[model samples]
Target: MQLNISRGPKATGKTVRLRQTAMKAGIKEKNILIGTSYPDRELEAKVLQLALRGLKVICIDECREEQLAFLRRVKDLICNSVTVHVVVAN
Candidate 1:
C-alpha cells in the first residue's frame, strides 16, 4: 500500500492537497474515507472503519498519536492496492 504523510501548520490546505491526490489517483469520492480528530472523534472512528473495509483511499487529518497506533494495528486491513494519506496539521 502507498502511504502519504502530510505535515504542516494549521490552514495549510492539507485537506485540499489530499483531495487533489485522491483525484489524481482516480479514487472516487465515495471510495475515499476522511478521518479527522477535530470537531468529532466518533465520526473519525466511523470513517476509519470504512477505510479498513478496503476503501480506495483513506485520509486522516490532524491525527493524534493514538490514532497513528490504531492505524498500525489495522494496517493489515488495508490492501496493497489501497493508498493512505495522513495529514497532520499543527
Candidate 2:
C-alpha cells in the first residue's frame, strides 16, 4: 500500500502513529515508507530505516520545487496497485 502523507507539522506525528498502528497489527517493520517535502538526506535515511523496519518511508525532497513531481512519481508507483491513501498537508 502507498500512502501520501501531508499535514504540515502533523505529518510527522501522523507518520509515527501509522507505524505504531501497523506494528500493533503485526505488520513487519520492513514494509512501511515515510516521505517528506523538505530536504534532509540524513533525516530521510533515518526515516527510511524506520520504515524499512516496519513503517512506510518518509520522503523528503531535496528540492522544494520538486515536491509535486515527487507526488506525481508516487502516484505513478501506486497506479498499478489496488489501494492508495493520500494525506494532504494542511
Candidate 3:
C-alpha cells in the first residue's frame, strides 16, 4: 500500500522513471501496469481487475491532480496488496 509519485513536465520521462522505480522495487515487468492515458471508467475497471490479479505497480501516466483521488480509491480497495505509482505532469 505504498504510494509513489513521478512528477515533471510533459515529455519529461515520467513513465520511464516510474518503470525504473518499479524495477528497483523488485516488481516484475509483467506485473506492472503501464498506464497510457488518463483514467476513464473502463480503464479504472481494468486497474482494479489487474490489482486483483497480482498487479504490483500501477504507473498512470498523464495524470491530472484530481485523478489522485481515483488512485487512492483503487489503493484502498486493493487493501494494501498493490503499490501505486502515479505520473503527473507539472
Best by lDDT: 3
List, residue by residue over 47-82, the lDDT tens digit for candidate 1. 456566757666565666555556665567556676
Overall local distance difference test of candidate 2: 0.42
TM-score-sorted candidate list, best first = 3, 1, 2
| Model 3, span 14-76: residue lDDT tens | 778877877887766665554545355555677788678886766565666666666666666
For model 2, residues 1-90, the per-residue Cα lDDT tens digits are 354444545446655655565566555446443334344354334443444455443333222333444445444433333222233444
Each candidate's TM vs. the true structure? Answer: 0.60, 0.33, 0.65
- Which stretches of model 3 miss by more than 4 angstroms? 10-13, 24-39
lDDT values of the candidates?
A: 0.63, 0.42, 0.68
Superposed on all Cα atoms, the candidates' RMSDs to the truth, in angstroms, are 3.8, 7.2, 3.1
In model 3, the Cα lDDT at residue 38 comes to 36
Better of 1 and 2 by lDDT: 1
2 or 3, greater by TM-score: 3
Which stretches of candidate 1 lie above 4 Å from their native place?
Answer: 25-34, 37-54
Better of 2 and 3 by lDDT: 3
